[model samples]
Target: MTIHLSKSRLKYLSRLGLFLFLLILSGLFYASCNTQSSRNQSGKAHLGESPMTDSMVVDQLIQRSRSFYEETGMRAEPFDRFLQEAMEIASRHNLLWQQVRILNTIGRRYRDRSAYGEALRYHNRALTIAQNINNKGLLSEVYNQIGVVFRRTDDNAIALDMHFKALRLAEETRDSFNISVAINSIGNVNANLGRYHSAIEYFLRALEYADRLDNTLGKAINNHNIGECRLKMGYPEEALEYFQKSLAYNNQIGSRAGQSICYNSIGAVYIAKDDPVTALEYLERALNINDRLGDLMQVSISHSKIGEVYLLLGDFAKADDHLNKSYELAKNIGSRFQAEESLRLLSRLHEANHNYATSLEYFKTATAYRDSILNEKNINHLTTMEAMLETEAQRNRIYQLNQMTSEQLITLGRQRLMLTIIIIIFVILAVITTLLIYQHRLRIKYNNLKNQHKLLRSQMNPHFIFNALSAIQVYVLEHDVEKSTKFLTDFAKLMRLVLKTSHHDFIPLKDESEILKYYLELQKLRFVSPFNYQITIDEGLDQENTFVPPMLTQPFVENAVEHGVRLMENQGHLDIRFKKLNTQMVVEVEDNGIGISSSIDQKQKSGINKKHESMAIKITKERLDVIRNDIGGKVSLEIIDKKNINPFDRGTLIRIILPIVSQNN
Candidate 1:
């Protein structure tokens, strides 16, 4: 039916209808967004200098980056401009040391981007440059850089070897920077190996350099690292002190990234202290910064942390909401570490609520991720080597093929074009098949490794740092020149290790043992021979062939003296022993101190007065998982409570079992 209406009435009806439609559409869009504010979208507190709209865009970019990772994997267009720039810098600079330095920088860029293949290429090129220059100093630096590549690729053994080389180089140069760098690197390697005492000594030494050089950044990093290591070794109060020092430097620098990390770390400490509100604030802060930075990696972690806090707060829906976000982000970012960690938090949360089936499902997911990451890390190493070899062989073949006369090649090209097509088809098909299989494996592996790393990188907590300077200050004030000299020398050596090894995975056993022995001697001087301690190893254990996780057993020994043995009224006694087993080594740290209780482990978990591991034990466990899974070996940990389990045993019994491989292997 058609009806003619007055022009004024028709226009009025049209305007009213349009207005109604607009209102309804706006309501629907608002509902879809859950009414999120521009600032809240990034989940950050509206702190100074943070704009709402800017935060929203950052959140959007973060989402986009995750989507990008999911769609394109880690295959970002290799910043060819940057690589070329570095190459040009290397070439134009006649100094081989400068070339090595540039190459190392390029390698680090690739490493940060998770492009191990490209990183390896640059690192190897740097190594060649160092060799050509015959600069032991550059060689040492290259070794350390190569170790970084190994750690990234999950070869802790090789990583340690390179770190050792760097440490030796540092010693040769007598340069405090390299010495500190090398020492710190070694201690970190030992810490990763579960030698917390060694890690502590190394960090203390690093503090010395940082102080000597007046390097606030280095000091803060080392202190933070030490606190992180101590948290694993079960020293909450000490860890917090270290973290505080770390924060001071980070604050002074006004580094948003460092601030975010410190906030999250502080939150972990608060959580350990049993404060959820503060934890949430810090986690949210970290999440906000990570979102703005388009760092899904850190965001996923913050999400999981928030989920954990919510779960503790008994908010099921809230917990699930954040956990789901975490999982989705982890999956989207192709970070198996985060996904697995999210699954774990979900598992624990559900299990606590008596949701066994759901818990099992989540647990299964976590396990799968764990396994997948391990495999991927392992294959990353092998595939990297394979890719390089294949590229080289192909290049050589291409060069040889190119050498033929132009006419001969043209005739050959025409004649063999058809036959070549068949062969090419077959080769292409085989390659595609292999790649498909490889990709499937790679996907599973990458996700798995991501989950493992997610848990380890959780913010610092209940941190600790051992300050040699304070002790030295005390000695100097007391006019104890002999003690001061000895302490200073040990301090210098330890600092050298920390500066060198902060970035490594594992270090040579000989080097680690040397540092540990030195640390023990220094501590003995501080204690004025309160008790004598012996570090005994079986035949062949000292060889570079036998390697352990960084900083595994040293802490328990230190704890015996610091908390247990030294507290005693009588003379203290400690026993540190190491024995190699078939493909494994058993390390025991026993002492005469106040006995351990059955509830100690549980107390440790709750972050009560008991020793706190922060994420140290978990990190070492994860790093070991990385090592064992990558190397086709197994690693295990056991802590023996002195009182309940063994009445006769007075102090703590810290046992470490490590996989033993031949030097070549």
Candidate 2:
């Protein structure tokens, strides 16, 4: 049946019986690949949801994005800036997974926007990162995302194969959410192959899992699939049943897009039964949703359906009007199914009116699209298979591991030398276990550091940009042209520094310290004389060689100025000191302003986080989760005199410590 189990489904293996059998036979956990890294959000915005609804914004965003790229054949600078910003945020805080996740999101967005080539690039970048970290989850997600692109490109076979691999990973990972998705994807491929029964079975299986997972969106999608198959089988009544149910589900979830799809499919069924009036009503409703959502794919499909209805109604001119519109959209988006459907309907409409030449032209176009679709499916199938076979080969490697474990044990009776060797091996195993524990700890440490770096990077820029722009605006408003010009120039230079550092693996301590000063200077312009500051860098400190996190210390300084100094009655004195003590390099920024209040918890802290003071702090903590691996040096944020700090704090003190490095090339 080629019913590949996704990692999420693999989690059910024990309960499902398949996993238990494999586990008992293998004597170790065989990876059910929950490799699909991203999860399908249940139908929050159904195909039936209104395009104008807030929920449809995401779909709308993708649709507009695709049009922009397709027509220009280029991505806008703002889009790239957003991506770059995401990267910067990830890098400064050292959040590798978050970075990869954001990259995946961008790729998915691009793919939906019909920027396949860009989508592929971002997906590959994410894949490469996931591979380096051996993050099976992330790798699975990238594969599934890549597979989705292929599916959209009309390489159904290849898409199916990639989806199978993704399913295996999802199963291995026990990710039920994506398992249902992978299952439905396979059903789609089978449907394309004309295996309607098999497709129904797959969809039904997906529905079972969806029900268990409480995934309403998945259920609706399955319903839609069932409706399509039934319609194809000439069961308009049955198709209507599924379509209506799907619409209800979509309505429950507020999925306008889902609603649109249901309407379109239902209209198609009615049209097949030669009920043009009902068809037009439903198709018109579908078109309204499509126009709002701006879903080009659905737009193409809806137009074709509308044209078919018009043709059947014997409205030659109206049918031709809709057909030409559908044809352009279908060709532009590369939807063979829509293109062919539109062309065929156009041919019939023309022939009915005795336009033989026009009808022949459309017939030829439909034939060409049909052939193109067929060729695409064939190539896609082969590609999908190649990936599946390679993954299967990886499974074979697991067998080799099993064989090795078996060979390591003596099958024959025990001997004196053998007994001694066994003891030694056991001891070695214990030592290795300890080493792995230590290594895991180290990994956690590095991961935390990586996360910390990313947070700092994310926090710094927006803060700087905001303050800089404010200063520039204030000067320009006062007609201080030269000052306004200077502020912008400085902002530009700082921005350049930020851009340069964004791509780097690390930055010099000197440059890192300098960034904080520029950041502080920008802030000073905003508050006027709200705060005062001092800077101390230890003598003989290797300015060029000493490494410090970019923007790591800036937040603390800014926090002190905004929350600590601004609240105080007296002149707020902010002190910054950097010193290398033995192997440890410490940077302390202390402020004498209003103290932190004991009443307010960390979560309520304002002016610090991007969202809240605590948000920035929490983000930093989450990002530093990787650092839990290392027990050595540390980075921390603590209010020195907790009682002295206030929500209207006198001021705050932040101390950061890290290992000092001597080498810089």
- Cα lDDT of candidate 2 equals 0.70
Q: Rate residue 13 of model 1 by lDDT.
A: 47
Per-residue CA lDDT of candidate 2, range 437-516, in tens? 65566556555655556545643546556767877888999999987876777666666776667544357877777776
Per-residue C-alpha lDDT of model 1 across residues 1-665, encoded as one tens digit per residue: 11112232335444655565565556656754674566364333211124445434434543454455445534553333434454453344343454566577667767776667778787877776566446787888878877877777766677888888888877888767776777777677777778888888988998898899888788878988898887787776788888888888988987667777777887888788798998899889889998887767788888899999999999988999999999999898788988999999999988989999999999999999999988877777876686557656755665666666666867876876566557555655565565556556655765565445443332212222244566788899999999889889986786576444443445567766765676676667666446778888889576576655445555565566676676667778888888877767777888777756633554676778754563555555665665555555557777676765766667777787777644565
Task: For candidate 1, report its TM-score.
Answer: 0.46
Cα distance off (Å), candidate 2, residue 385? 12
* TM agreement with the true structure for every prediction: 0.46, 0.44
Q: Which stretches of candidate 1 lie over 4 Å from their true place?
A: 1-79, 92-98, 113-118, 353-355, 383-665
